[model samples]
Target chain A: MKQLKIIKIGGGIIDDAASLAQFLHLFAQVDGPKILVHGGGKGASEMLRALGIAPQLVNGRRITDAATLDTVTMFYAGKTNKAIVAGLQQNRVNALGLSGADGNVIRAVKRPVREIDYGFVGDLTPAGVDAALLGALLGLGLTPVICAITHDGQGQLLNTNADTIAATVAVALSEKFVVELHYCFEKNGVLLDVNDDNSVIEKINLTSYAELKEAGIIADGMIPKLDNSFDALSQGVSKVIIGHALKINDSLKTVLCLN
Target chain B: MKQLKIIKIGGGIIDDAASLAQFLHLFAQVDGPKILVHGGGKGASEMLRALGIAPQLVNGRRITDAATLDTVTMFYAGKTNKAIVAGLQQNRVNALGLSGADGNVIRAVKRPVREIDYGFVGDLTPAGVDAALLGALLGLGLTPVICAITHDGQGQLLNTNADTIAATVAVALSEKFVVELHYCFEKNGVLLDVNDDNSVIEKINLTSYAELKEAGIIADGMIPKLDNSFDALSQGVSKVIIGHALKINDSLKTVLCLN
Candidate 1:
């Protein structure tokens, strides 16, 4: 199977244009068929404030109202996505920007109201991914830059988590490719000591990941990301890497496997 | 040659949600391979005003600054384009939204600074369009929903004219498909009597268009649109239709031809 790398970039890299461009320049250097999934950065929140839409949260968790959904959709799927696509194009990559609604690529279910209504938020599964179409796009040599906005296939666009999108897409494409999912952020890698960026773990398997969790080194924010990573690994994704966005080509990164 | 319809819609239908939805339903019912090109409606301006970006116009032409470009990119490529695509998907049409940057479908040159400097504005010709890829996309049964945003292939996104993009793509794809370019707006068609909506000139040849201009009926905004239509017709587009967005399936529209 051909090797395919799927990289997801979040707020830390995206909030700054210079860092984002530097990351994209580095990303372009990493060879092979690749897909980029990007998160909604602080720009959306700032824009919301500019638009006078009060931040609505229930029990400290953000809620995506209709207006918030519209704003984020524009920010993620429009400005940031196109900027990244054009940037990649400048690097001589034929990048195609997409919202899930573009090809119905990832049909998600609007998150059902449990304790709090997450209005217009989407929860998706790997089965909802259109792996064949993505494969066809890759075959055409067009790199896809996907935004974190998916549709319910019934005309509603939903805000989604970029990490989950990358992992789900990786799992779905694992059948056709040796999928390696990378979660790129601010730090060097998953740190052995949370305060030291250079305290990289190097590698972590299922047992080590459990030990790390028990040791409380991989707690809080790192927990969900690693859990999502392990979920992908268990479901056929070859490997999951966590590293700095700008240092993607470097050797110092944490690689997770089911081994 | 296989028949293809490339439709362009502007502010009249797009500004109203109910009207835009009605138009999308009408668009889905149009037979054969089709492409939809959309103009930036009042939404961009409203958002800009809300965000305190004062409208900058030099000699009646809107000048796109960096901030304006960002806002418009989000509005057109992100919000409007995705909304249309999702709506079409709801109507059972597999619509793929695109910016000119996507697939590098339309590489444009930033308008040169001369007497008036149009910042971040793209000027493009039919030759700049990637006809083969568009034809391939159409072959895959995907309806392309293009926003009026092009890139300079050097990481710059330019605000382009939707009508021009529509006509240029029509001319470019004419080599592979019998292209019928449709311009949808408020009126039924080119009005024979400026005051009467019922007075639509159903068929317009070049000779009559010249006479209409001489008579002042086809003056102002209609001039550029008709000029673009004839240019497309002369280049290779089989025909150009000017009509109302709602009455797309009806015959109450003006059809422009060379002969």
Candidate 2:
């Protein structure tokens, strides 16, 4: 069976160029096919401010109104997307940057809101994800660097969460390939003790993840990350790893199962 | 009949906040159904450089190689797209930003290269333009701000020229609306002499444009602008105006009409 990996770099990992570089180095050496999806949550917010626009978020996702939508497209798709691609190129890795809107690779409908409108946030429909096209790109020896942006049916920008994007891609590509979800952050791994970086959990199954979340040990952003990891696994992905971007190799060894 | 205008701002016009502000002021006063399509050629290139990526342009268009394509999408679709939308919002215009790939609004086939491989550039087919969806947005009292980025059928980034995009859009919407193509620049208008900025020609018809080209007076980038303008007019656009962005009202008097 062919090997495929979907590595998602968190906003924290992307904020640090050094960590991103380290992750890219490991990504370049990895055998088999891989797709890299990244988020520019903080970067995009800062950029919007510099341009004299206030960033807005709705339901943990960026509210991509007309103005905010343009900013996200420019910053996420233009600046951060190019920077990541350039960094990969410097390491002699052939990477292609893409938006979910491009080629309808990720088709979606605007997430309908009841009271406060979420503007252009989209909920992915199964019809929207294109695994065959992505598989072909990987077969051509190219790594796809995807930005977390999508579009509604009527030509609108929708800010998508990168974690969900990675999970969706992993599930879509899992049947024909061994899919591994690498969730890279600044810390070593999912810690058993919140204060201890050395208390890295060697591995996590779906049951442990549920227990941790239920006990409130994993709250906030970590909850979504864990949820998305299990979602991918349930959809047929072979493994899911949550680890530090800089020390990804160690985490990969612990998390990825080949069989 | 509801009058509709397709105002196109060159990437040059929106390079800075001041210029954007000036354009937005003009944009707000235009009371009609309108669509705004913008270019980010220079802005995208500059941001690419900041990220240490050398942008390669073939035939005056960014060659969307794996690296450059990634950068272009981020900059054009994300950064530049948002800045314009934000500027419009700051000026009280509810402008929404969108790309050609949205809802398959603008689809095209990858242009087959003749001399050099223009990696990921697209040639717009008539079937690719989405006028109805755009018309629906205008009918809903929203000005659509479009970025000149599109996707080929195979999920590849296609570097499309802004002028062509504007022209195609004009033609696409011509049946239901009176479409006008406004080509705004820093100069007062197209001048007879290259050295004199004050030598702004008040008006010119298609015949005069041909005469100027025949005399070798029109050269470089101006040639394409005139070509695209004429293409729009010939394809049923009500008129095409070329002038300073701030002098849109004055430029309206010099509109080139086929009739």
Candidate 3:
């Protein structure tokens, strides 16, 4: 099987123009087929405020009402996606930006009316991804840059989590490729000490990840992120990498393995 | 040569929900491979107004400064493009939405400041389109839904005119396909009398078009639009159709030939 890298970048890099440019430069240097999945940055929130709509959050997750969905769709799928694609183009990468609605690449179901009613949020499963179409796009020498927007295939667009999108896509494409999922953000890696910049935990297997969580070294917000990474590994992803977006080509990053 | 229909829809239909849905349904039924290029509708202007940015226009053409470019890019490439793609997806068309920056399918040069500084606006030529990539996309059994946003290939997004994008794309693809360029607007073809819905001009050739212009039968804004259609015909586009968006399947329309 061929090798494919699925890289996901969060708001920290996207919100800063210089860091995003540096990341794009490094990404262009990566040799092999890859897909970039990006999250909506703070820009969306700013725009929401500008438009006089205050964002609603429940348990660190956005409560995606219709207006918020519209704003985030514009920011993520529109402005940020286009900017990143144009930057990659300038760096000589033939990048094509996509919302899940494009090509019906990711058909998601609206998170059912649960306790909170997360208005227009989508919950995706591995079965929702169109792996063959993605493979065809990569076969065409195009790197797809996906935004955190998906449709229900019944004509309703939904706000989705970018990390979940990347993981799901990585798992789907694993049938055809040795998929390496990279979660790129502002950190060097999973930190050994919360306040130390150089306290990088280089590698974490499933056992040590449990120990690290039990030891309180990987507590707080990193828990869910690492949980998601391990989930991808268990589902046949070859490896998962966590590192700074600008340091993608460097060896100083955390690597996760199922073992 | 294979037949390819390149359809361009203006703002009027897009501004209305039912009409846009009807147009998409009609578009999905058109046999053979096709591409849809849509203009930035009133949504952008509404957004600009909501954001408290007064839109600037010079002689009916928008002056796309940096802020204006950002808003239009979000509306056209983001919201409108995705809405159309999802709608087509519901109708079972494998629609892939694109900004010109995506796949580097179209690259444009920023309009130079001669008499007017149109800011970040792009002026496209036929040579700027990547016909082979488009052919590859079409070969993949996907319908491309292109928005009127292009890149300068130097990390800048330029607001492009959708009509020119359609015509230029038609000319570009003529090498591989028998291209029929359809300009679908609110009116049912070029009316002999602007007030009468039944005054449809069934067919117009170069000679008759010239005579109509001399006889003042085609005047005002319609003159420039027809000029563009004839120019496209002369440039090797197989034909240009002018019709109401909803009446595309019916024969109550005008067809321009180079004869």
Candidate 4:
């Protein structure tokens, strides 16, 4: 059986058709069973603003308030999901779109609040999944496109993070596959210096991650990305790559661990 | 506490924007804790064909073969999921998109093949859901926009059905809130006369369902749908509404039962 690889595309990289097309072109070259997890934070926020709504974020996560939730359901599931599917089809890649709520794929409980409130956010619990279904789709030579929304036991929608979703999926498939998590962005790679483009770090192991954190090299948004990568690695993923969505060849060099 | 409602959007309705926008507009008026679960079957299949890949279905369920699995991950999670989010945002709904792989929301085991080989499909099992997380989100007045995809215990992506997803979610939340399920489509309602537009049934109860089924008034696609609805009702869903997606007001009128 071919090994499986899981890749995550950041909101920054997925905001445009050109970037998405470029990414898909490269992705078509990769071998084995692969899955892509993506974020729509930037687009979703922009759409909200255009609709005269103020977007709210709780700890960097979007708050799916009543109105916002409706917008997201329509936009993410209806528009963005189809655009991606159509894009892949235009590129000659078979793609099927879906959400966690479709098959109780991700059963969630509402997020608990002690001090701050995060509306419609859910924390996931362990539920048995149907791997045979996935294998069957792969066997039929179709690509599965998944969205980052789930449901609680009672069929309520929940907002979930893309990085976490990718990491968890990688862990779940690690035993039978080689999970390769890619964090595609505009940057070349993980930079060692904020100002120097030449300060890209070739690689860093788990042991060295703390040192970088202590040195204040990894902070803010990068923190969650790295944390999610490490989480997947610890859970038996083969590799985690962070690089540019465009220029896949250049990123592939970094991804291949040839740096 | 606001009552919880679970609204399920069908692929037929979500296939186009005009219908989806209208659906979201109505969803915005649901003044309570609500969750949105959506499907992308038709879109996924159409996209797959355009990409030169043939879709495989086993007994009306998608066969998630290796290539199909890859296609769906990209189509469902990356595209359809975001599209829905974007649409909701257009209406000022702060929707966040997600898959089950995030937060381990829904865990499952690799479903063993029975009669036919349906690769990569998953069946749901009982696992604790994080209701507190959802409750917090609802408490904060956020709506959840969910996609139908989940992960197995080993972390592999599993293809699942939208109706089943909605049913399980409804059951999960029944204990804490009033779970109102709306399965929307282009049809006015379940029809007794397949060719007669006026044959729309106002309501269906558990007692009447058998007669309808026996008389062959409920067949084909409606069978599975009604089965799912009844399952939810049996499991304690407060109500199930089946109607046309475009006739929003009329659709809301077919309330099957109220708890």
Tell me the TM-score of each prediction against the true structure: 0.98, 0.57, 0.99, 0.53
Model 3 RMSD in Å is 0.8
> Which tens-of-lDDT digit does each residue in A68-146 have in candidate 3?
9889999999999999999999999999999999999999999999689999999999899999999999999999999
Q: What's model 4's interface RMSD, roughly to a tenth of an angstrom?
A: 13.7
Q: Give the TM-score ranking, best first.
A: 3, 1, 2, 4
Listing candidates in order, what is each one's chain A TM-score?
Answer: 0.97, 0.90, 0.98, 0.88
Alpha carbon lDDT at B226, candidate 4 = 81
Using TM-score as the measure, the top candidate is 3
| Candidate 4 local lDDT, A74-147, one digit each (tens) | 55554455556555544555555555554344446677886777887766532322344445445545566666
Model 2, residue B111: distance off in Å is: 1.0
lDDT of 4 at B10: 79
DockQ of each: 0.91, 0.12, 0.90, 0.04
Compose the digit string of candidate 3's lDDT tens values, residues B1-259.
9999999999998999999999999999999999999997899999999999899999999999889999999999998999999999999999999999999999999999999999998999889999999999999999999999999999999999999999999999999999999999989998888899899999999999999899888999998899999999988999999999998888899999998
Candidate 3 chain B: 10-residue stretch with minimal lDDT? B186-195
Candidate 2 per-residue lDDT over residues B1-259, each given as its tens digit: 5678888878667777677777778888887888888888477777667656898865566677876776677777676775566456555565656666543567777889788888877788556786776776566455778877776534355778777888888888897898878877777777778787777766777788888889887788888777777777888888887777887766333466664
Off by over 4 Å in 3: none
On a 0 to 1 TM-score scale, where does candidate 1 land against the true structure?
0.98
Best by lDDT: 3
